[model samples]
Target: MRSKYTSFTLSIALAWGVWGCAPSTGTPHPPAAVAPSVPTSAATPAASPVTSDTEAGREPPPAEGGPLPSAERAGGHEPPPSRFPEQRITLMAVGDIMVHDEQLEAARLPDGSNYDFAPFFNQVAPIFQEADWLIGNLETTLAGAELKYTGYPMFNSPDSLADTLKQLGFTALTTANNHSLDRREAGVLRTIEALDRAGIQHTGTFRDEASRNQPLLLTKDGFTLALIAYTYGTNGIPIPKGKPYLVNLIDPALIKADIARAREAGVDLVAVALHFGNEYQRQPSAAQREIAGLCIQYGADLVLGAHPHVVQPYEWKTVTLESGMSHNGLIAYSLGNFISAQRRDYKDVGVILKLTLHKGENGEASFEEAEWIPTYVHYYRKNGKRQYVIYPVSLTLAAVQQGQKDPALTKEVLNTLHRLEKEMKLHLDSLQKQEKAS
Candidate 1:
């Protein structure tokens, strides 16, 4: 998967950690020496350079067992003031980050081993740097060299992907996708250890009983946020004879129970990351809609989805809590592939959905507003020596809404995202129409 930046202040991180008492053990390492941006094949001369070395395949020093650096240690440039209002908690969520074979091969160092990914993330780090928190789906196993790494059918990515993720501003990552157990049981343990060492947090797959029972909690901007992750299946991989707890599955009864615990703990917000839906499908399935509705009813405030390997529509959903209280939530049905080798249509385009929650003067917290950034991942020159570099489309909706010099290419990307969005809209509309008729 590709890396991007997200920024926040160190003081804020310290304040949150002390106040919330959530262990901040695995924070990402600071960014490294300066570098130049690798201009994309399709990039205009005016496009900003992608400067971070992580994107360029440089590795950062290990961040394990040291006194954590100040919040500035969190890599990436701070977000603009306008992006985050005062006294609010903002979260940015992205889709699947699949580390295919090509990525690993490119990441290999001179020692004939995989290099760490933290450095490469420094390039696009600014995008996520500003949010109070960031989330993404890790669609590969961290099984290390003991197991071979491959793409498509099964994936065992470099363990260093966790370090890259932490540096890129991800507080929590979901591991409950179809490829969750690509290397079997060993991959699960190694992945968790890698994340733990980097001080990054994770949910979904677990190596043991303790990891399985742990609920990832992050306190940001005076709000306590809880994250829970689950997937529909494990690419048909058996969950080790009697180990149903190895990975979380989307079970309604279990989800309701989990939400109940979060609410009882008085978490300010509850976010559910679901690895569901069909591969490359533009819209959510009936099962996805039903499960999302169930999450809302059970007290989840935001729902992020994945496993489509392509972009899906986003919706602003509101539901009444069991206490007869109304609340707003964002259901990003699917975020598509953040960075991958996939050349399929909307599969190359994804959305970074940002949500903010604020505590009003009256001591009440409410959902504020939401924004979506449309991104495209244009593969670098696949023909020859420059095959390793992949340029994630950085243009905004405003930029793409206008026609491009290459109308055909622009049309292809936008049309794919738009069609997916339309599919999501149609599903919602059908539900609304049925309600009216009833």
Candidate 2:
């Protein structure tokens, strides 16, 4: 298969605040798509380099070879200089993790009883590990092997996928998507069990009402963040009777309530992962813009969206809350497919969205910086065997431009890379024009 490389300018910005939170359970319902008037902009600004003192929450480095100072020195009362404490955390998010039949077959082990997906992610593991928390959309169900492995129309993947994700340093996953109910209630329950076993936190779907009632809370570097996920609908599959809480749906009221709950819980940041958008479309639909604005209005600090199966533009908005307070937030309409079998233009490309967050001495959390690295999924055969790997697009392009050949890359891949690079340049130019006009 051919591939493409693209280039786009990254924006950098100063600090920003967090959002509110709340929780609620509900049945699956389709949200009407409404086109909202909004302007498209480049991705959020790149994160500033975290200073050593801020990152380690420590005072300035002491003089080399010098003894550390103490409160009491030489039998006299000597107080150390006072300094405010600060901490920094980095978060990375990606698009859908879809395991199609081709992927499942590629992962089959020699024993035939299991599959190993670890190899597929090895190339990108270092990038993922660079962030303090790595998050992604789990678009397939790990309902166990008893139900048989399938893909596409309905997905039921082996539990090994979850195991691989956990080993790759994924801190959490958003399980709300069109395929969440492909295996029915049993599938949902088993998926949750598998995630729990892997020690990865998840949101959007739950095995029980009680679990659904609670928010997914994560604490790191003196900052508390709450994540909530919701999907447009469950692909026409009715949620189990009286168990509307099984999968989160796109409902503005419920989402706002969840945000309130997160705030009430004293979370420093609230992020909403929304699985709603037109599939295979490079541009976000009207409904996406509407809901994104609503999310910001309801106190969401960051909105990460998915399900378009293709990367979409990013927008930054300054919203005014009910109390007349203004907040700056970001929205990534669609992250696209992180990994998949689809070969359509843009379908095989995605991005790793990274954000830097800082907590000040006053106990306030804010967004420090935001940026993304484009990625491409490479499918090739090696040693008479099939292999699937993801590569950073920029690196791949650089090697090709240098006339270096990779065994895993093909002529088609080079052509696709060039095409993507051209397209991205045009897209960025368009955004710049729009910004100038605004």
Best by lDDT: 2
Q: Rate the local accuracy (lDDT) of all candidates.
A: 0.64, 0.76
lDDT digits (tens) for residues 109-191 of candidate 1: 65875665443343246667667898899988878876876777798876677777877788888888888788888888888
Which regions of candidate 1 are displaced past 4 Å? 1-86, 116-123, 386-438
State the displacement of the C-alpha of residue 349, model 1, in Å, after optimal TM-score superposition: 1.3
Where does candidate 2 stray beyond 4 Å? Answer: 1-11, 14-84, 398-405, 425-436
Tens-digit lDDT track of model 2 for 315-403? 76556677665666677888888998877678888887877676656455656555556778888877767788887776677867798
